[model samples]
Target: MADITTPDLPHSRHWRFSLDIEAIGWLILDRAETSTNTLSQEVLSELEQLMDPIESLAASEQMRGLVMLSDKDNGFAAGADISEFDDIAEPEVLRAALERTHRLFARLEQLSVPTAAGIHGFCLGGGLELALACHYRIAVDDDATRIGFPEVKLGIFPGFGGTGRSIRQAGPVDAMQMMLSGRNLRATQAKRIGIVDKLVRHRDTLRWAGRKAVLEKRRAKAAGLTERAAAMGPVRGYTARKMREETEKKVRPEHYPAPFALIDLFEKYGDDPLAMIGHESDAFIPLMNSDTAANLRRIFFLTEDLKKQRQRGSSFKRVHVVGAGVMGGDIAAWCALRGMAVTLQDLNMERIKPALDRARKLFQKRLKKRHLVDTAMLRLEPDPSGRGVARADVIIEAVLEDLEIKRNVFADVEEQAKPDAILATNTSSIELERIAEGLKDPGRLIGLHFFNPVAQLPLVEVVRSEHNSDEAVARGASFALAIAKSPVVVRSKPGFLVNRVLMPYMLGAVERVEKGESKELLDAAAVAFGMPMGPIELMDMVGLDVGKSVAQELGHDVPEGSQFNELVSAGKLGRKSGEGFYRWEDGKAVKGEVPEHADLQGLGRELVVPLVDATEAAVADGVVESPEKADIGVVLGTGFAPFRGGPLKARADGKV
Candidate 1:
C-alpha cells in the first residue's frame, strides 16, 4: 500500500485523487481541517469540483473505475457537518442545499466506471448515503466500523438520497428500522442486510482490495427474495404499520416528527427512488425547524465537545475497584472492556465471581467478538485481598453508601494504594468532602460516580471535592472518558448532580402514590412527558430501599407514610422483591391499577416541575457549574427525555 500525490491530478484539503496500479482512481477522503471527516459545504464544493474532471475522463474512456477510501487513521465520514444545518433556517435554502447534495451523489452514482466505497470506522448519515451511491461497497470487519443513518437522533431524517437508496438496496422494512431507530450496524450485519458488498479483514489493505474488487467489477448479488418480499407492496405496508406501532409505544409522534415522517416516506414511496428521496426532504424540513430539533442538536454538540475534552492525569493504565457490588463490578468490567488493566477487590471470591460474571456477560452481549472479549477478560484481575491497589494508578471504592463504611474504606484504600494514584469514590449520594475527611492526601480523592448497568449508560459524574487539586480532578475526568463514559465534572455535595436533581422528582412521585393516586397514572405521566421510564418505574428499578436511603441522605421532603416507606416495611424492595407499585414478571413491570380518568397533563407537570426547580437550584448553588452540565447529567444519568433536552431545556421550551 502506497500514497501517490502529484500536481498532475486535482487535489483538495478534504479529498484527493490517486491512480492505483490498474489505473483505477482512488478518491481518498481525508478532511484536512478536522480529525473526523464531515461533509461540510467546503468539502461538498471540493468533491463537486473533483468530479467535474472525473466525469470528463469517464466520457473519454480514460478512467477505469473509482474506489473511494479515507486517508484518516480510521473513519470514512461521520456525517454532514450538523453545525451547518443551523444556518439553513429557511425551507427554500434547506431545499436548495439538499438538492445540491443529491445532485453530487447522483453524479457519483452515474459514474461511467464501476464505483466502490471502502469504508472503515464510522460511515454514518451522509457518509452512508455517499457509500450507497457507489456500485459496490467493501467495509472492514471490526467492532469499530459502524455504518448507519443516525440523523433521526438529531430530530431529522437523512436528507440526502439515504432513505431511497437504502430501501432500494436493502428493502423498505429494514430501512425504516435502521433510520427510525438510529441504530448502527456492524460490518457483518451490514453485509447480511445487503448494505456492504464485500468485507475486508484489515483497514490498511482496504484501498488496494477495493480497487481490485472494482476493477473486476463483479455485479454484487441483489437482496434475497425474502428480503425483497418483506419490503415491497402489501407486505411493506404491514411492516411499516408494525414499525409505527412499536415507535408509538416509546415515542410520541407530536414530540418527535422524524420517525413518523420516515415511516410515511418509505411506506408511500418505496418503489420510486426519485419520489422517495423527494419526500425525505419534505419530511425533514419541519423536523429540522422544530424546537425539538434545536434542542437535540445542542445535545449533539455537547457530546461532540465532550469527546475532544482532554485532561492531565497519571496514565490511567491500571484501575483498582474496591467493592464487588453491582456498581463496582460493572465499573471494573467497563474499564477492562476499554483495554485498561483492572483489579476488582471484594470481600471474597464468592462476591468477586458475580462481578466478574456480570462483566463477562456484558462483554459477550455487546462485542460478540471472542478475541476482544478474551482480551478484556484477561485485563480484569480478581483480588480478594484488595492487594491490587498497590499496582493501580486509580483506586475507586464502590462500597455501601454509608458515611462511616465509606470513610473506613477510603482509609484502607489510601493506606494500600500509591500516593500519586487517584482515589475515587463511586458514592451516588454522599458528599465527597465528608468521605475524604481526615484522609491523607485528600487531593487525590475525588468522586467517580457510575450509574447502574454501567456498560450501557454513558455518563460518569466526576465529582470534585473542595480539597481536590486541578490535576486530581482532571485525572478523574480523564479516567471517566477512557472508559467511554461522558464525564460531567461536578462539585461535591449530597447526591452530587444527577441524584441531587432527581431527589425532588422521586419524592414528589412517591408522595403522589402515597396519596392514593394510581401507580400506573404517575408512571404514565412521566412516560408521556418523554422520560424513558416513569419516576415510579425508575425507583423500582433502582430498588425502593435505595431510593428511600438517597431521599434521606439528600434531605428530600417525602411525606410520612409514603409508599416508599410502606414498601420497605413490607419487604417489597422493588424489582428484587418483584412487588412494589407494580408486579414484576420476567424482568418486566406488570403494572397495577390505573386511574380511569386522571389529569395526565397536569400530573406530568407535577412530576416535571420539581426536577426543573431542583436543577435550577443546583446551578445557582454552584453544585453544577452550568446549565449544560445539568442538562448532560439528567440526559445521560437519569434518562431524562433527550428529545426534550433535559429539564431546563424543556422548561425553556415551555414543555415543562
Candidate 2:
C-alpha cells in the first residue's frame, strides 16, 4: 500500500493547509469529513490561518514555487456551502464574513511563491473565485468536471471576488454574463474564455498540472497576470452596471434588497479584487436573513431533493416512443439524445419516417455541437408497426389525447410489449384513471405529461393513476432521469397538474378583459410580475380551439366561466388561426381593442374574483379534496409555474 495522509497537520483551522519540504512548494488543502469541500466560515477562517504556515515555510526557503492540490482526493471544492447563508442572522454579519474571506483571499494572492491550483470536478462559485486569485489555474479535462459562478440563481452575485476576477480574467462581457446568468461552463468552454491555464485529460492531469505550474513560476511573464487585471477598465464598469439592470428585470417585488446590495458593493469596489471580497459581508447577512431568501433557498433545496428522489438509485438503458406526431418525435429525440436507446413507432411508414426524420435532425444538430456521438444513431430506431417494442423497456405514448385512440393503441401495443416495460402516456386534459381503465396490465400505465416542444420545456409531470403500481411510477421516474428532464409526480386528474392551475389564471385574465381592464394592460401587469409569458399571449399561442376544448372538458367538473368558447365560436383560435384576443399578421400579435360584438370591457373585477374564488372553493367543496390534490392537477396537468408553490398558496395569498 502507498503512504496516505498529509504530514505536519492534525488539522489547520477550517481545514489542514500544510506545505511539504519538496523541491517545489506543494500545499495540501484537505478538509475532513466531507464528500466535497466548500468554503464555509470555519473553512475560510482556516484558510486565513494557513498564511502563517506559508510565511514560516517561505522563511526557510526550501521550495521554489507552490503547486496547489487537494489532499482528500474527494474532488475539488464545490464552491461555497449554500446552507450557511440560508440561516445567517443578519446582513451586517454576512458583510463581516465577506470582509474576513476577502482579507484571507487577498493575503493568499500576495504569496511570494507563484501559486497554481490543480482543479477537478465541480469548481464553482466561491471555489472558482478562490482559484482565480492564483497566478495559474490548471484543470483535468474530465467530462465530469464543471466550472462556473452560478450565483445568479441564488438571487445573488458572486461575493468572494468572483465578479471582478472572472471579468478581468475572461474580459468584461463574458464575466458579466457569467455572474448574471449563473450558467455553468464545462472544460472546453472554460478554456475558450481564458479561465483555464491548461486542460489535460486524466492520464496526464497530475503530471501536466504539476509541471506546468513549475514552468509558469519560472517565467517572468507569469508575474503579470495581476497587471492585466485593469486592461478592460471602463468596459468592466459598464458591463457590471448593465448586468445589474438586466438582473433587476427578473428580480420580483421591485424593492427586493439583493440586487441593489450587489450593485452598491460592486460600484464601490468591483475593480479592486481584494476590496470587493470585503464588501460581500454587508449583502450576505441581510440577504441570508430575509424571508424571500428563505423561500428561495427552500425552493432550491426542493429542486435538488426532487432530482435525487426521482433518481432513487435506478436507471434505464432503453426507452420507446409510440405515435409519430410532434410529441412522440420530440420524446424519442430527447431520450436518444440523452443516451437511451429509443424505438419510435407509428401506424405506417409515412408517419414513422417523419418522426424518425425529426429525431435524426435533432441528433445531427447535437453532433454538430459535439454533444452527440455516432453510436447515438444506432440507438434510435423508427418502426411503422411497433417493430422494436420487444427490445424496449420503457414506452412513452404520445398519441392524440383521445380516450378511444389511446386505449385502442395500448390494447395492441400491450400484446407486443415486454412484461416489465413501462407504459407512459403524454395526454393533456385527460384523466390517467380512465386511460388505465381497460388495460390488462393497468399497473404499468403511468402518465408522463411532457409539455409541447418536449426538448425545450424543463418540466415533466409523472402521473401515477390509482391503478398504476409503485414499480411503474419508479420506472417512469427512472426514464425521465435517463433523459435528464425535471420530473414531478402528480395525481391522476383531467389537466392533471399544470393545466389545472393555469385554467384559473386564464379565466382570471379573460374576466379582467370582461371587467373594463384592457387586455394589454393586464398582460403588462403579468409581465411586471415575472411570468415567462403573459396569460393572454399564452392563450393565443395555445390556440382558441384547443384551449376552448380543454377548458370545456376540464371545467365540466368544476365551476362555470368557460372563457374560450366565445373566442372559438368567433373563429379566433390564436396563432394557429392568425387571430385571437389580439390579431396575428406577418408572424406577430398586433394588439387589438375589444371586439365589437364581444364587448365585456365595462365589467368589474368581481368577474375575475368569481373564477379564482370558485376554483379555490371548488377544491374545498369536494371539487378537489385538498390543496395537494388540486395542486397536482394544476402543476402536472395544467402547466402552472412551479416556483409559485401551487394554486393553494396563490389562493391563500389572494393572488389566484
Pick the TM-score winner: 1
Quality of model 1 by C-alpha lDDT: 0.84
Q: Show the lowest summed lDDT stretch of 10 residues, model 1.
A: 1-10
lDDT, model 2, position 155: 54
Candidate of highest lDDT: 1
lDDT per residue (tens digit) for residues 472-550 in model 2:
7777766776677766776676665566656666767766666666777666555444345567877887776666667
Q: What TM-score do all the candidates reach, one by one?
A: 0.96, 0.83
lDDT per residue (tens digit) for residues 314-423 in model 1: 46898999899888998999898888999999889999998889888888987688987888899999999887889898899999878899999988888878878889
User: What TM-score does candidate 1 reach?
Assistant: 0.96
List candidate 2 stretches off by more than 4 Å: 1-6, 12-21, 24-35, 45-51, 69-75, 218-271, 283-285, 311-313, 352-378, 514-517, 556-563, 566-572, 576-578, 583-588, 592-656
Lowest-lDDT window of 10 residues in candidate 2?
Answer: 597-606
